[model samples]
Target chain A: MLKISKKADYALMALQHIAAVQFGDVTPGRVVNTKEIAEEYNIPLELLAKVLQTLAKNALIESHNGPKGGYLLARRAHQITIAQILESIEGPLGITDCSHEKDGEFCMQRENCHIRTPLLKVQDSIAQLLNNMTLQDMMGGTPLITIQSPTAQGVER
Target chain B: MLKISKKADYALMALQHIAAVQFGDVTPGRVVNTKEIAEEYNIPLELLAKVLQTLAKNALIESHNGPKGGYLLARRAHQITIAQILESIEGPLGITDCSHEKDGEFCMQRENCHIRTPLLKVQDSIAQLLNNMTLQDMMGGTPLITIQSPTAQGVER
Candidate 1:
């Protein structure tokens, strides 16, 4: 199945946890340990720790090494979109290799393949939705609207 | 970047090759060799051979060996959607684990997470596109159209 890797999944969960506590006075700018975050979300400790480290490496979240150190959002929750979190963990958001503009030189069929065009559209729609959502938006408990209804005609996006 | 796996990519290339010749005098049951398909599309012979075997295993295509042997579509080209070819190689088309209905049971945040809903919409959009596109349609070189332009978004399906 096409899936967000384990890294991306953990990153989102961690971001949401950080967002949930952002408004609290005591924990403001404080290091949030991976243990605490993993326990809160019921995620595997070792896996979540690795994921947290990855987020830190990507600059999506800040980390410290001393006694009270853990992780924190590098920027404000509102400033971090789901797309950034995803990209931080999973690399670029693209459906087909041919859809990537960054390395278009590699695909031999780039000049004439018709499938690339529609797949690009699919990628665009997904990006639009992800870009519109921020960690804060998710924390705000906003109702996510369906882009296509189960009964609706047309494409799923 | 979000990308289709090598398997799905090869499957599509192979299907398109088959569709291009579907209208010829050759019977639907005729077998086409992997080497010919690899040569036609300039794909690696070993890789194309493995992909063709996978397609046959998934019933997307059928194969035969011996003096007069190769591969043939298990069904009419028009009846085979792009989704089937992709799923055969990549499994379910999903952006995240939670996007899958079956995996919902295992998701830790299924009850409260907001991202799943919109992500599901994106998944549906992708599914619809794949479902609508047939091997025949791709072979016919239909001009692809999308409701939105590619650059406006950032999410990858």
Candidate 2:
């Protein structure tokens, strides 16, 4: 029942793209633009552009200026955790709105709320798992098909 | 970014109400009807009824037929896990639509989808947490306020 928001998913996908083309610590191997990623992933260019800017603002990826310059990972792939990407896009992982981490008590049953503690624990544990998971961890799943034959291997395989 | 559905939340609340009034094996100390839970939680009666039916269908809670009869925990509170409640309401936890568990591959980037592995891990880990966690774990947070003063202790405290 728990689900990650679509924007957060978009951010993950976008980050994985940059991470895949990552070159070195300071400069990216390829300064992949938003349009390039949008076309490849079939994502909306306008939406993906907004998401990329948010990533740049969060410092997960730095936006390069001028032509041929677009986006690159601010940190190494393995060094950046999925939690950071998600938090950068969706704030800290919150399973329930009435979580202790939330500012004010909006839930009516706060005092008698039985699920609060367990819900908070679930939120923390999920955050912990995501915090430990890096973008490289997700990028690791990209090796099944080789790029030799795009239509055959990449498409059908 | 991750969140449990409202129906699932309602199901948990309803089950907890029954679990709170549980007596012993076979017969409950108190039979809880859906309306009681709906009014108590301020949930819509119709929606909560459908959710309660799902809980009954999943065998998480036993349904009573007569006027005095209502609902009871199908199994002991501790015997029921939050996963059971959540699954009963929302099906198995799914982080991404393109996970291996899905019937057919839908995403165009399925072959090169780098997130499949890590997303599945997150799904499985979350399911693992919910599976191991019993309903009693959430119910444990309900011991703070006593029933002495309704307005003062329960509302203001």
Candidate 3:
């Protein structure tokens, strides 16, 4: 199973919530507080806060610290992809460390690992798909997948 | 990050180990014992046994009993896909339960869950990629990821 961590999920949901409110207006000052999002979405405050912090640290979103402080997107919705949001919160996205050439922590059997190269391709396939999907494409009722023959193509919204 | 469980990792490694030894011979009796696989791969015996048991139950592999007994693929290497192996070892492959209509445990805000549908599409994209890859493909030294531009097309080994 390919599982996205809860933190990554929350980061996406939170970003979508903010995007929905902004409605393509990329103004820097328009923001939503963590409490408002948590209450509206029923996400646990602590968990959502932590997820938001990572997003801010990755510069995907900006945070204000005043009494009326809140959060806003650092860039336009179309500029951020699902792959970027996921990697920001959860680290590099790949099947395993053996698939990563720069990763220092290779499995002990990696030198003799037969599955490494192929799994790296699987990883790239996944990364390409995710990288193609943006936050703007995720919002609204538009269908993301269009089945034109056996090959499923993604429609970028 | 999209994550495949350790059990699934071990399962793939073990299956690849068996497939490499078989060398495309679809004979039903070339067996590789769990002990040998665990020792060779440095995988924990208890964990590999559990994963193998799941594979056996799923009928992806046939297990033999007794002192000289071990296991062999239930079908040809080309017949078994990475999706099947992962699903057999690790339940259904998806990012979230909210995407599953029959899944009773929907998030508290499922009615307002804006990302569920798009996430489902993401899950399908991953599954389709995995389904295209077979156990036989993993056994060879062929480059799995052929970068045909930034699209990252999967090459059948």
Top candidate when judged by lDDT against the true structure? 3
User: Each candidate: RMSD to true structure?
Assistant: 6.2, 9.5, 4.7
Question: What fraction of the true interface does each of the listed models get right, in terms of native contacts kept?
Answer: 0.42, 0.54, 0.58
TM-scores, all models, native as reference: 0.73, 0.81, 0.85
- Interface RMSD, candidates in the order listed: 6.4, 12.4, 4.1
Candidate 1 wrongly placed segments (more than 4 Å): A24-31, A42-50, A53-59, A62-70, A74-78, A101-104, A108-114, A140-142, A145-157, B24-31, B94-122, B142-157
Tens-place lDDT digits, model 1, residues B1-157: 5677866777887787676565555555455788877776667899888888888999887777787788777888778877898888877787787664573375775655545655555556556656765665554443323344354221222
Tens digits of per-residue lDDT, candidate 3, A1-157, equal 6777778888888999888776655653466899998998888999999999989999998999988789888888989988899999888886875655665665766655667667766776677777777899887866454322122343232
Tens digits of per-residue lDDT for model 2, A1-157:
5666677878888898888777535554888999988888877889889999999999899999899889988998778888899888887667776654456647765555567666766676666666666776565334436434333221110
**For residues A71-150, could you state the per-residue lDDT of candidate 1 as single tens digits?**
77788877888788888778888778766566436575443354565456556756766776677766655434333312
lDDT of predicted model 2? 0.72
Where model 2 places Cα greater than 4 Å from the true spot, the runs are A24-28, A100-104, A144-157, B24-28, B100-104, B141-157
TM-score for candidate 1 (chain B)? 0.78
DockQ for the candidate 1 complex? 0.31
| Candidate 3, chain B, TM-score (2 decimals) | 0.83
- CA lDDT, candidate 1, residue A51: 82
- The TM-scores that each candidate's chain B achieves against the reference are 0.78, 0.80, 0.83
Instruction: Give the best candidate by DockQ.
Output: 3
